[model samples]
Target: MSFCSWFKEEEYRNHFEPGLYVCVECEYELFSSQAKYEHHTPWPAFTKTVHKDSVSKVPEEGRPGALKVSCGKCGNGLGHEFLKDGPDGKMSRF
Candidate 1:
C-alpha cells in the first residue's frame, strides 16, 4: 500500500493550538507554538518548522504530485507540505 493511503482526509484538516510539538518516539522538537496557523484543513497546520532540519520531505511514489513530510531524526511520517498563500501574500509551506 502507498504511504499516503495510510492517512485519512480528516487527519490533515484538524486544527491545533499554538504550542510545541515533538515526535512521539524520539521527543525531537519538530514545531513551535509560533508556527501554528489555522489553514481550515483537516490536519493541523504550521507556517514553518522549528528549524531547517526539523523535517524531511519524501517524494510519494504512488502519488506523483504529492510529497510526504516526515520527522528528520526518526523518520516518522508527519504529513504533507503544500505551497499555500500565507497572510503575507507569499507562498508558505503548510
Candidate 2:
C-alpha cells in the first residue's frame, strides 16, 4: 500500500500535484502543488514560493551556510533552504 496523500501522486513526478501546500499551523499558502517536484527524498520539495514576502529566514546555528526559513505570517519554522538541483538544472530556492 502507498502512503502518499497527494491527490495525483500517481502521475505527479517533478510536477505540481494539482492543489495547494500550506503551513499546518498557520494555514498560510506556501507553494502551489504545481511547483512540486520529485526530489527522491522523504521531504516534499518545491521549485519556488507561491506567495511573495511570505517567508522569513535566519542563519542556522550549527550549519555554517544553511539558513532556516519560516512562515512570515505566523513565524512558524518551515525548514532550511540550501542550493539543490532545480527542475531547470539550476539552483533551487526555499
Top-TM-score structure, candidate number? 2
Worst 10 residues of 2 by lDDT: 1-10
- For 41-84, candidate 2 gives per-residue lDDT tens digits of 44566777778866777777887756677887898877666544
Candidate 2 whole-model C-alpha lDDT, 0 to 1: 0.64
Encode model 1's per-residue lDDT on 26-80: one tens digit a residue.
8888887677665645456567778788888866677654677788899988766
TM-score per candidate: 0.68, 0.70
Question: Clashing residue pairs, candidate 2?
Answer: 16-33, 16-34
Question: Which ranges in model 1 have alpha carbons more than 4 Å from their true place?
Answer: 1-18, 85-94
Report every candidate's CA lDDT. 0.63, 0.64
